[model samples]
Target: MSTPARRTGRPRSAEADRAILGATRAALVELGWGKLTMGDVAARAGVAKTTLYRRWAGKNELVVDAVAAVFDEHLEAADHGSLRADIEDVVVRFATLLERPETKTALMAVVSEATHDEALGARVRSAIVDRQKRLVLVGRERAQLRGELPPEEDPAAAARNADLIFDVIAGSVVHRLLVSAEPVDREWARSFATVLLHGLAAASSGTGTAPAPEPAREHRQKPAGSV
Candidate 1:
């Protein structure tokens, strides 16, 4: 996500930044990602086109930051008192956010496009995915503190465990809500959470273990100038 740039070497305007991102999402609702443009967003935001150019290189970066802003604001994990409750809260919350017309349409469009654009994919992962992963980490720590989970002796293993949990939660919600066109209400959240927390807590207790990942078959060559 590109930071909104300073205007003519002065500090950036938080108000203007908010307006621009707000305008972007609003535009996505009306026009969808294919038809939204920087000029259109600037017009909606009541700002000069140059103001947008100063902050973002183009539409891809702008839309990404716009969507990122929404996720950051709306999708935080609340203290639900238990891992199951937290998972249920997060799943329902994520579903509710994606149910919004602007977020549903815009995020799906950008993610589809990002499949072919590595840099854009990384931006989506960093700006959105990584931010959500932190919430998972926070919730996991809370579970540990409550004695709902044991502390992994290896830090690296703990990190991997968190990553796996995040993938499962995100994948299940996105597939159910978006692809399956199904509801993700409290009942569904509870059932799903029960299943997920079962294997998760079981593994931590040594009653079950996650299967070993298959070894990588190969490494693809990185693109030029790629990180």
Candidate 2:
């Protein structure tokens, strides 16, 4: 008789991962971070508690994974013909994600706790913030290829610039959503994009000031005799 093939244990399910993460987000929205538990997520996901524990150590890791998935779910690499358009598109998408009740609550609660938890803080940086910053680098590289942005002569400066831009865009949106309690709608994103793009264009061209407002046109009767 031929030897029987060896069999491995059951494979993990992608559907389970999605369900667990989705349930985690729902739990965060309904229970907040402090009250959320693996049991609750397991019940919500229709899986056993051991299933969740097998995938993540505890609430922090699971929440971070869930939140990161939310961010990744809607993110798209925009190629909107111009950097300004691309930035605006990304801004709108990010704003949409922040507007969701689950995302807003989970992000703030985790960030607040992470301030005192170094490991959690590092996880937040790696899982979510760093991925968000990648969008900026993508837009910048695309703009450079399209001749909209000049190639950087100094790699360090380029990196710093990218970091700064990421902070501005992400920070502003968060502030609007959480601190200011305002909507980051399309109009607001467009306005923000205009200001950001103009500033960038000015910096790239080494023009610090706003062209002196065209010297007010100097329309002093247009020299009545000199027409």
Model 2, span 43-88: residue lDDT tens? 9999999888888999999999899998988887688886777988
Cα lDDT, model 1, residue 77: 76
Task: Judge candidate 2 against the unseen true structure and give its global Cα lDDT, from 0 to 1.
Answer: 0.83
TM-score of 1: 0.83
CA lDDT for candidate 1: 0.83
Superposed on all Cα atoms, model 1 deviates from the true structure by an RMSD in Å of 11.1
lDDT for each residue of candidate 1 in 43-102, tens digit (9 for 90 to 100): 999999999998999989998998899899898879878677788898999999999988
Candidate 2 regions exceeding 4 Å error are: 1-8, 200-227
Deviation in Å, model 2, residue 114 alpha carbon: 0.6
Q: What is the Cα-based lDDT of residue 212 in candidate 2?
A: 18
Per-candidate TM-score against the hidden true structure: 0.83, 0.82
